[model samples]
Target: MKNKKRARSYPVVQVLSKTVYLAIPVIILFIVVSWFSFSEIRKQNNLAVENTVNIYQTELGHRLSAITHFIQWTVVHDPILDGFVRENHMGDYRNASNELRLRVSDMQYSTGDEYQYFFYWDEKDIFFNASEIKVDYDTYKEIKEKIRSDVKSKEDPTGSFSWKPFSFGGKEFLYYMITYRHRTFACLVSMEDILSPLYSLNLGENGSISAISPDGEVFYKTKEGPAGIISSVYNRQLFPASKSLLPFSLAIDSRVLGNYGKLFVLQVIVFLAALMLSFIMAGYILVSYKKVILPIKMFSKSLSEMDSVSDGEGLDLTDSKIQELNQINEQFKNLIHEITRLRIDIYEAELDKNKFMIHFLQQQIKPHFYLNCLTTVDSMVSLGDIDAAKKMLMFTSKYFRYLFQVDMNTVPLINEVQHVEDYLSIQNMRLSRSTLYEADIPSECNSMEIPPLLLITFIENSVKHAVPPEGESLKIWIKCRMMNHNAMEIIICDNGQGFSRDVLTKIRNGEDMEEDGNHIGITNCIKRLGLLYDNNFKLLTENNKPRGAKITLRIPVNDK
Candidate 1:
C-alpha cells in the first residue's frame, strides 16, 4: 500500500514542486501589491471626476431654478400683466408693457445678460424683448408658430414650465415658455452661452462634457470622439424644483486614468510585465490540472455512469495518459461487464414472470364475464325469445374467440376496436336496452398496434354501470388517434352514472379494487398494462362533468 501511494504521489507532487520556484512567490506578491495600488489610483481619479460632475450639476441646477423663479414672479403672477389682460384701454397696455420690459432688463443685467426674455400679448398681437427691440408682425407670427410647434412636440405635463429646443434664425436655442391666461412669457438661452461655464473645467486631456436637451439633441459637447466610462446627471435628478431643465453627461477617457506624469512610461512597463507573469502562472496551473486532476475526474465519472449500462455495452474509457489510472479503469470495466451479464439474466427472468402474471390476470376476469353471458342467454331462452338468444350467443362467441388469442401480446388497433363493438352488442342484448354508441377512430391510427382486449375492459365497466333515465338510452363513445410519430392514444367514455369517489381513489392509488366484484375488471386491466408496457404507457381515469366516466390510455409504439 505504501508503494502504491508513493506511485500515485510522484507525478502531481513533482510537477507542482518543479513549477513553484522561490522567485514565483516574490513575483506574485509584487503583482498583487502593484495591482492594488494601480486600481486604487484609477478608482480615486474616477471618483474625483464623478464628484466634479455632480458639483457642476448642482450649481447649474440652482442657476436655472433662480431664473425660472424670476420669470414666474415677474411675468405669470404680476398684477401689471393681469391688468393688461383684463382692461380694454390702450394706456393700460402701454403702461404694463413698459413695466414688464424694465423688470426683464434688470434681471438680464443682474445675470450678466446670459438669458434673453420676451413678453407677448395675445389680444393685441404685440411682442417685445428685454432690449426693447420690436420685430415686424410677420417675424412675430413666425416666432409664435415655432413656440406652438415646440410646445406640441415637447410638452411636459408634470410641470408649469415647458422647456423645448427650437431653431430660429439658423441657431438652436433652448426655449422656456410659460403661458398664463392667454398671455405668453418666455426665456431663451443659446446652447453655447449656457455651456460656457463647463468649458473652463479642467477635465484631463481626453475628458469630455456634454449638455443634452430633453429631445436627445446634443446641445453642446467639449470633445467629439468615442466616449469612455460615461457618468450622467439629469436636470430633474439634480434640481427637483426646476424639472424642465437640460441634462448633462461627462466621460473620462481610460487613457487619462493611467497618466502619471513623468513616471507614466515606467509604470506602463511594470504593468505589462506583471500581466505577462500572471499569464505564465496561469499556464503552469492549467498544465498541472491537465496532467493530474483531469484523469481522476474521468475515472469517477465512468464509475458513476456504470449504473446505467444494462445491455452489456463496453464503457470504452479513453486512455488517461497515466499508467495507474488506465489500469484502474480497465479493472472497473471488467467488473462492470460481469455485473451486466448477471443483470441481463435476472432481467429476462423477470420479464417472463411478468408475461405469465399478465396472462393469469387476463384469465381472472374471464370466468365472471362468461358466467354472466351464460345466465343472460338462459334468461332469454326461458322467456321464449329464441332469436334474441341466438343473436346474444353469436356476439358472445365472436368476443370470446377474439379473447382466446392469448399468444398475441398485441393486436392491430382496428381488431381491438372490433372486439369492443362485440362486447357492447353483447351487453345491449343482455340488458334489453338501447345504447347510443359513437366511434371516431381515424384511418391513420387503424394500423397501429395495441394490447388486445384493452378497450373492452373499460367499455364493459361502462356498460354495466351506465344507468340512464326511463326513456333515455345509454351513451358510450370510443375515440382513437395517433398522438405523434411515436405514440397513440385511446379514450373510452360514457354518459351514464360515472365512477364513485371511493372507487376512483382506489384506482388512482393502484389498489386491488375488488369490492363485491365491483372494479375487478379495471384492476386486472391496469395490472396487465403495467406488465406489458413497463413504464412506457400511461393510464388515467376521471369522472366527466354532468355524469360520465372517462378512461384515457397513451401507449408508446415502435416503427416496424
Candidate 2:
C-alpha cells in the first residue's frame, strides 16, 4: 500500500509543488498590475471629472451670460423704458407694458418654464411688472431683499447676479436679481427647472450635486438619499468647486471619485481569477492520480478479495472518497448485474464456455441500481411529479439493462436517442418547465452505431448553459441526419448565454482547460471523442444568431 501510494504520488505532488512557486510570482504580478490599473483609472477619472466640471461650468457660464445679456438688452433697449424712465413719452403705461411683454414672446431660451419679469425704476424706487403675471408678492419681496442684501455685501456687483429660493402657496421659485444701469430686474424661475440639469448628470452612485450660496446655504440639492445625512455631514468629501453659477457655486461629491465601483469589480474579478487558476492548476495535476492510479487500485483490490465466482458477483466499491470512484463503482455494479444474469449459463459453461462468457459480460440489472431509482422516484412523487417519475422508473430498468449490455461500448443510434430522451424527461420533471428539448433525427439514421454517452455529453452541455431565467422559455434542439460518404452529422443548439470566444476556442481545440463551469464538461467530452475517433471526426462550433451556441459533430456511421 505504501509503495502504491508513493508510486501514485510522484507526478502530482512534485509538479504541483513546483507549480505553486511559479503561481506566487504570477499572483504578485497581478496585484502590482491591478494596483497600477486602479491608480491610472482614478487618475484619468479625476482628470475627466475636473475637465467635465470645467466644461460644464463654462457651458453654464455661457448659458447664464446669455440670460444676463437677455435681461441687460431688455432694459437698455425698451422703447417703453424711455417713456417711463425719462418721463417724456408716456401715452398710457398699460399699453406700453403690454407692448414690452408681447416682444418677450418672440424670445427663445433653453429653460422649459417661463421666468418672472419685473422692471425697477431707480429714480422712483418702485417696482412694476411688464405684464400681469402670477407671483406671490410677499414671498418675492422677502427673496428680493435677500438678494439686495447680498449684492450690497459684495465689494463688486458689476456683471454679478443674486439668486435665492422663495416658497409660497406650496410652490418653490428661484429669484434671480441683477442691477443694470440705474435699474434692477428680477426673474423668477421654478426651483424644479433650475435643478433639472443637475439631476440628469451622471454623478457617481452615492454622489450628489448641489448649488451653495456664498453664505454656504444649499437651495438646490439632488433628492436621492436615504443617506441624505451623509451629504449633510461629509462636507470634507464634497467637491465644492465647479465654477460659481454667478451668486452660487456648484458642489459635487468627489471624495469617492473616479468610477470606484467598476474598478473594484475589476480588481475582484482578477483576484478571484488568479486564485481560481492557481487552484485549478493544482487540481489538474491531481487528475492523473484520480483517474488512472485510483482505478487500478480499486480493480486490484476487487480482484484480490474474490474467493469464488459468486464472491465477485457483489464487488461494488462505495467506500472511496474521490468523486471519480463513482464511475468505476458504477462499472463494477453493472459487471455484477451481468454475472447474476449469467449464473444459470455459467452452470452450463462446462458444455459451452464461449456461450457462457458472452452471457456473463452483459445484464440483469443490480438491486442497488434499482433501489437508487426507487429513492429518486419517491422524491419526485413527493414533489408532485408522480406520473413523470413513474414513467422514468419504468425506463430506468430498461436503460440500465441496455446500458450494460452494449458489448463493445457502442450502440445503435436509436437506442442512444431513446436513452437521452428518457434522461431528459426525468431531468425536465426535476426542473419543471425551465427547459424544453426537441430532437429530430431521420429514421434511416437510427441504425447507425456510435459510442455510448458520446452524444449525451453535448446534450448535457445544452442543458446546463442554455436554460432561460424564470418566466422565459429555454429551447434546445438536437438534430441529426446522415451526411455524404457514410458519415453522420449531429447538431446540438441551445438558446442560452452561448459560449464565449475563449470557451469556444478551447472546445474547438479539444482542450479541457476551461474552469467556467460551462466549458469544462464540454471539452472533457471532446477529449474523449478525440481519443476514440483519432483524426476520423470533424467538429465545428459557432455562436447562434441573437443568442446561444451551436455544436456540430460528424462521425463515421459504422462503429468499426
Candidate 3:
C-alpha cells in the first residue's frame, strides 16, 4: 500500500504572505506622496527666486527716482545758484559752487552715498563751473557742447538730460541732468551714489541691485565682476531722452539657476531615501505580522481547543514551531487545575453552611431545655432540696443563656468580661473551687468594632479546659488597651495548666484540633477575624510565665 502525503501547516508563512499582499498598496501610496512632495518643493523654490528678483527690481527703480528728484530740488532751491545767476560773475559762480559742494558732501553722508556734485552753466558768458575744485576737462567740454547746441537750436532745455562717455577724474560716469527755467544748472551725481541706497536698504545676503542710464551705461552694480554685470540688463531704446520711460524688466539671476539645479538634485536624493525608508517600514510590519501576530493566533487557537476538553481530560498543545504557544498551552492546563479547585471550594462552602445550620438549631434547643429544667430546680430549691437544686439550676442557666444569646456576639470588652464573671459565678456555686476573675478593659477601646462571639469562644475554652484541681484556687485575668495609635489589644490569662507544645503549634498554624468538637468555636472565630480584618488583625496563643495559658488578640482600629 502507498503512504498518503500529509498537508503542511505554517501559520507564520500564511501571515507573511497576507502581509506582503497588503504592503503592495501602501508602498505605491508612499511613492506617489513622495513624488508630489518633491514636485511641490521645486515649484515653491522657483517661485521664491522669481519673487526675490521682482522685489529687488522694484526697490532699485524707486531708489534711482529718489536720487534724480533730490538733484532736481537742489538745482531749483539752492541760494548759491540764485546768487550766482543774479550777479552773472565767474568769481561769484566759483564761490557759490564751492559752498554748495561742501553742503552737498555733508548731505551725501546722511544719504549713504560716496559723492553729490553740482554743476552750473552761465548762458551769457558761455562759462561752466562744477562744484568740485578739480573738474574733468573732458566731461566739462562734453556738457558745454551739449548746452551750446541746445541754445543755438532754441530748443526746450528744461527737461530731463543724459550724457554718455562722460569722463570724471579719469573714470567714466553716466550723467543724469535736469534743467531749470530761470537758472541753467546741471547736477552731476555719480551713478554709483544713485544706486548706493540699495546697500543701506538691507536687501539680505542673496539679492542684488543695479542702476542703469537711458544710454545703457551702468551707474552702479552690487556684487562684483561678470556675475554683477551679467545679472543686470538695460534697454537703451526703451528709456531714450526723447521717449517716455518704461518699467524696468526683472528676471531671476542666472547664478540662481545653478542653485535650483543643486536643489533639484537634493530633492531627488531625499525622495529616493524616503522611498527606501517606506519599503523598510513595510518589510518590518510584514515581518512583525509573521513573527508576532501568527504566534499569538496559534496560541489563541490552542486555548480554544483546550477549553473544549471535558473534566479530567488532558490536551496536547506542544507545537514545535511556536514556543510561546506551547507556554500558553501550559497555562491553559493550569487554568483547568484552578477550575477543579473552585469546584472543591463550592463543595466546602455548602458543607460549612449545613454545619452552621445544625449548630444554630442545637443552640436554639439548649435555651428551651435549660429554661424548663431551671424552673423545676428553682421550685425544688424553694421546697427544701436547696443545695442540689441550686447547683443544677446555676449550671444549666449560665451555659444555656450564653448559647442562646445571639445578640451578645459583638458586645464591648467590658460587657464580655462581665459575661465571663457571670459564668464563673455559676461555676463557683456548683463546685468547691474558688476562682477569682478580674477584668481591666480600657474605656477608650469600648466603642471599637469587633466580631461577635470571638471573645466568648476564647473565654469558654479557657474555663472549660483550664479548671484547677481540688484545693487549688483558679485565677483568671483579662485586660484590654490601645497597643498603639491605630491598634487595640486584649490579653486573657489564667493560672491553670497550660497546653502542650503540640497543641499550641496546632492552634497557631490554624490546624484543626482532634481532642474536642468544641474547638470549632475557636476555629470559627479565627475564620471570622480573617474575613473581617484581613491583614489588620493578629491573634497569638502562648503559655504564661510559670503556669497557665495566655491568649492575646490585636485588632486595628477602624478610622472610618
Candidate 4:
C-alpha cells in the first residue's frame, strides 16, 4: 500500500496562525494612540506651565498694587507721617520713623528685613533715618541726589526705586525708594515676598520658574538655563510660558521626564494587551483540541481496538464538551450496539455450522463401525460362539442407543467414559482380548460436562494405531482428573509408535486433513475441540519415552 500524505495528529497542537495578524493591528493602533496621546501631553504640559507663570505674575502685580494702595491709606490715615509732611523738624522725622517701625516691623519676616525707615527732604537736601543722627551721617548721598533730580524732573512726587544696597550704621539694606508729598522715603525689600507665590506653583520634580526684572536682573529663578535648551522639541513649540511678558516664565521639568514618558506607557499597554490576546488564543486552541480533535482521536483509537472475526462486543462512546460531539458519540454508541448484535449473529451461525459438521462426521463413522460390529456378531453366531456373539451384539446396541439419545455438544463425563468402555469391549472381544485399555476417570470428574464423542475419537485412534508387542499386551490409559476449580484434564496414552514426523508437524501447525485424510480420527477430534473450546482448551500430543502417543486435553468442566 502507498503511504499518502500524513495529517497532523492534532491540529490545535500546531502553532496558531493568528498571532502575527493580531499583533500587527494591535501595534498599529497603539502607535496611532500613542502619537495622539503624546501630542496632548505636550500641549497640556505647556498649558500647565503657562497657567503657573500667569497666576504667579498676576499675584505679584496685585500684591504690589495692594502695597501701593496700603501706603496711600497710611499717608491719609496716620497723623505721624502727616505731621512729618507738615512740619520740617528732626522731632517730626523721629516720630514718623517711630510710626513706620510700629506699622512695618511685624511684617519684616515676610520681607527678609528689619524695620528701618529713611526719609529724605528734597527741598532741604536733608535725610533722616530711624536714627536721625546715625543714618544722617553718610550712606544716603547717592539716593538723596537721585531723589532730588527725580522730584524736579518727574511730574508726580510719587516715585519708586528698585532694590539697592544702602550701607548705613554699618548695615546693608536692599532698599526701595518712594515719594509722598515732598518727602522721599526708602524702605528695605527682598525676593522673599515674591518667593511665597513662586514656590506655591506646582514645580514638580525638575520644574522651574523664573521672575526676571525688566532691567534684566534675575529676581528669582529656580534654575539657571532657559526651558528651550533643555529639550530639543521645546524650541519648535511656543507657549505662554512667560506670563504677560512681565515677571517670570514657568517650564515643566524636563530632567525628570519619567512622569510623562507616554510612549513607554503605550508600549506597556500594548504588550499587556498582546499578552492577554495570546493567552486567549491559546485557550481557544486548547479548547478546540480538547472538545474537537481529542475526541476524534479517542474515537479513532477505539476503532483500532475492534476486530470483525473475534470481537463480539461494541465500543463505548466517550464524552464531549460540545453538543455536536456528544451527538456524534451517541450515534457511534448506537452503531456499535448494532455491530455487536451482528457479530453475535455471526458467531451463532458459525457455532451451528460446526455442530452440523460434527453430526455429519459422527453419522459417517457410526454406521461404518456398527456394520463391522454386526458382521463380527454374525460370524461368531455362525461359528456357534453364541455367548461371544450376544456380548458383541449387546455392547453395540447399548453404544448406539447412548449415542442416539445423548446430546452431541455436551455429555456427562461418566456416560462418555462408559460409552468408550462399551466400544473397547466390542474391539477387545473382536480381537480376542489383544488390547489392554485402562480408564482412570474419578467419580468427582465423571459429572463434568464435555463433548459427547470427545473420548471416543481418541480411543478409536488408539485402537487402530496400537500394535501389540511381540510378547507383551498393548497398554492404554484413559486418565481423567480434576485439574483445578474451573477445568479438568484427560490424558489418553498408549504404548504404540507415535505419529510420524510429517504428521506431527501437520498437527502442530493446526492443518486440516489432506485428501487421503490419514488419521482422520485425530483430525476430527481436533476440529471438535476447536469448535467447542475455541483456543482455551489444551490439546497437546507428544511421543512417550517408551514409544507411545500421549494426548492430553484440558477442557472446562460443568458439574451440572
Please, what is the whole-model Cα lDDT of each candidate in the order they appear? 0.69, 0.64, 0.59, 0.64
State the lDDT of candidate 4 residue by residue for 1-560, as single tens digits. 22322222333223345445655776777677667666766666656555665676576556544445445555446565665654467776666667766665544444324334456666655665532222443546654565566567867676554444343335433455567677666554344444555565444444555444444444454555334445543322222324342333333343222245665776687677677767867876785675467767876776677664233444554543333444554576577679879999999989887776666456535666778898899899999999999888899888888877765578888888888889888888877656787788778987888987778887887788766556878788989889888899999998888777777777888886666667777776787677677767888878888788888989887796
The C-alpha local distance difference test score for the whole of candidate 3 amounts to: 0.59
lDDT per residue as tens, model 1, 269-338:
6677677777777878797777767766876787678668754575645543455565564676677678
Better of 3 and 4 by lDDT: 4
lDDT of 4: 0.64
| Candidate numbers sorted by TM-score from highest down | 1, 4, 2, 3
Q: What shift in Å separates residue 243 of candidate 1 from its native position after superposition? A: 14
Q: Which stretches of candidate 4 lie over 4 Å from their true place?
A: 1-322, 325-348, 355-364
Backbone collisions counted per model: 0, 0, 1, 0
User: Residue by residue across 446-558, what tens digits does model 3's lDDT show?
Assistant: 67656545566777677677856557788888888897878888898888887778778877899877576645566666666665566578888898877898989898764
Per-candidate TM-scores read: 0.50, 0.37, 0.34, 0.41
Look at candidate 1 and tell me the lDDT of residue 308.
80
lDDT of 3 at 35: 65
Error of 4 at 293 (Å): 23
Quote model 2's TM-score: 0.37
